[model samples]
Target: MISESTPLAAVEQAMQALLDDVVPLASESVALGEATGRVLAEAVEATMDVPPFDNSAMDGYALHHSDAGHTLPIIGRVAAGDSPLALERGTCARIFTGGALPEGADCVVMQEKACVTDGHATLPGDVPEGDNVRRRGRDVAQGSQLLGAGMRLDAAALGHLAAQGIDKVQVRCKPRVALLSTGDEIIEPGKPLASGQIYNSNRPMLVALLEGFGADVIHIQHVPDNAEDTRRCLREAALAADIVVSTGGVSVGEEDHVKAALEALGELNLWRLAIRPGKPLALGRLPGGDGQLTRFVGLPGNPVSGYVGAWLFLRPLLGAMQGCTAMAELPRLWATSTFGTSTGPRQHYMRVRLDFSREGIQAHAFTDQNSGVLSSCVGADALAVVPPHSQVAQGDLLECLWLKA
Candidate 1:
């Protein structure tokens, strides 16, 4: 339904509109073992203090600070997990690492700092109070917020939860996605190639990217370039998935049936963003059962276009849907440019490899930036954003979006 008179939408404007329409999915409680890479739905509070009690930092002698500069008789021994013991004045308890500090003991003299002879220990004269002792709640306090909502559960975060005796947590459910690849000329790999047919490369690539963004790909189908087939596929996808993403058949060509089919089934909210290699991007919604509407995204057929669009658009969309604060935006850093380029009315996202050195970070752009050159994306570290009508030169600072896994 887009025409020459249809103005191009800025990238930021389109992104904001898409995000505004998202309604996060439901949350569920999952075991800690299964929570890796999931976003927390609620904040976690510490049930008990970390290190529960004051303990020795290492193998040491637990003693009162006043006993400094004196040879104290060894009254008893204590190791980790032993019940608390009372320390008499002028007497010390031989304690090992993580051992609970005894009553009346204010400091621990490490074994290396003491000389033991004939059941007595000689301590340094200047032992300070509370030295080498890990106080209760030093790492985390009881009833304090341990992890905030919308935080992704990484290894360290999971370990922190384990420390708090949390075996399960509430996390946002993964978004269900349906991916469609259009064009009859596209053939699956390992199939005998016809004269005019090319192997389908977008499916596997997009699947990996979608999974990387924490989406559960529920449906994957190749749609032939026909209005009837496109509409049928879109309807089926909408019914089964929360989001339907398609590649190809979005441009204004006669063979492009996806746009017409989308308009027939639902509403086309946006089309034609002002960005190179992905200008013909489409955003729409499709009607679903139970009065629910499924979100839709149409990407260009070029492999590079699909790849770039996945990072620029799909990543943030999924992040917002899952309420993940960290995934809401790509991490950007300014890097010195190692190549020169000029842009037109549309902004360009060039794939580049970053060089981190003592001096600073530098971006090395691939030589071939054409949309059809999928090889340009291999091992790419970041996307260098070149603004419209701007000329960039070597040594100039350019903002780059880091391509994190």
Candidate 2:
């Protein structure tokens, strides 16, 4: 019953219990070029130095610091693809950006800062030692660990590995999640729904949401509200995938059958959360098909409520499977609210839009903020969060979670 009211921590603890049983669904080796957004299964150690050697930072002259102020002969030229260079005293190489610096050269003087006349360049600036010099092994030394296990790949990290000459990496496989919706009053899209049935929008919305989280929804099916059939579908889905997410029937209503089904199979736990629009959601596990066990997330029926639950809870668990160490940490952004608002004992997610100008950020809350109205979510750039029982002033600092989620 969760009569005492479920705190956010309780929900988090429940989520952690389910995630403890999670392992990468499967793994496949991928070339480093295609590994962006993939989860690393093993630590990636640098096999060679990044940049491999000292390199030019700009199209300039490279020479020893002893020749910083005096004229040096333009003895050679080095572009991106030329062979290794050798340097001598009072010698400067016309080096292009990304070209390796010649041996014995320690600094690069920008061409704009030097006057070249008669094959000799006069450096005007007092360039410091190691100035503009990307030393050998300075960025990342050979045999050093570049990224650790459980690190999710991002663009910057990928560039780091590419600079180290790593062509491939071992990554945690993406998990396959199965989606199923149960209710007698639901109908598939593209067909005109009958009087008692509504077009199933939640399924499609959840499908895209799961995909955005880097999960593969292998199978999404519609199960009738009938108890036995719902049980059978859930049973099969549990065995078929690592996690199964159902969008209805968790509440204690006559049509609700998920609780009974879970009880029939294994242990079942439910929480009536302290958050508005998501109090009816539940989580549990059972012995699924193929003699395997799996985690289950039962979200509310309202489209926006289901989405909120998916983002707040399901996103973190799925992220953990993808090797992200801090998946549950939501982004915290700050803004000033345009108007004061009332909050309940339960936490709330109010749709908000931000205005950025010379006046600074002004957050405007949506007029229609019902959880059933998914329209507010369509163009929402942020969510203005109010902690439990807090009263906000018009110009008060407010936490706005960005829609990047």
- lDDT top scorer: 1
Q: Please, what is the TM-score per model? A: 0.96, 0.88
What are the per-residue Cα lDDT tens digits for candidate 1 across 97-165?
999999999899999889999999999988889999999999999999999998888999999999988
Residues 1-119 of candidate 2 have per-residue lDDT tens digits of 33234444345566666576666555679999888878788888888877777888889998988888898899999998787569998889899988888888888998899899999
lDDT at 171, model 1: 95
Each prediction's whole-model lDDT (CA): 0.93, 0.80
Candidate 1 residue runs with Cα over 4 Å from true position: none
| C-alpha root-mean-square deviation, candidate 1 | 1.6
| Backbone collision tally, model 1 | 0
TM-score, structure 1 vs. true: 0.96
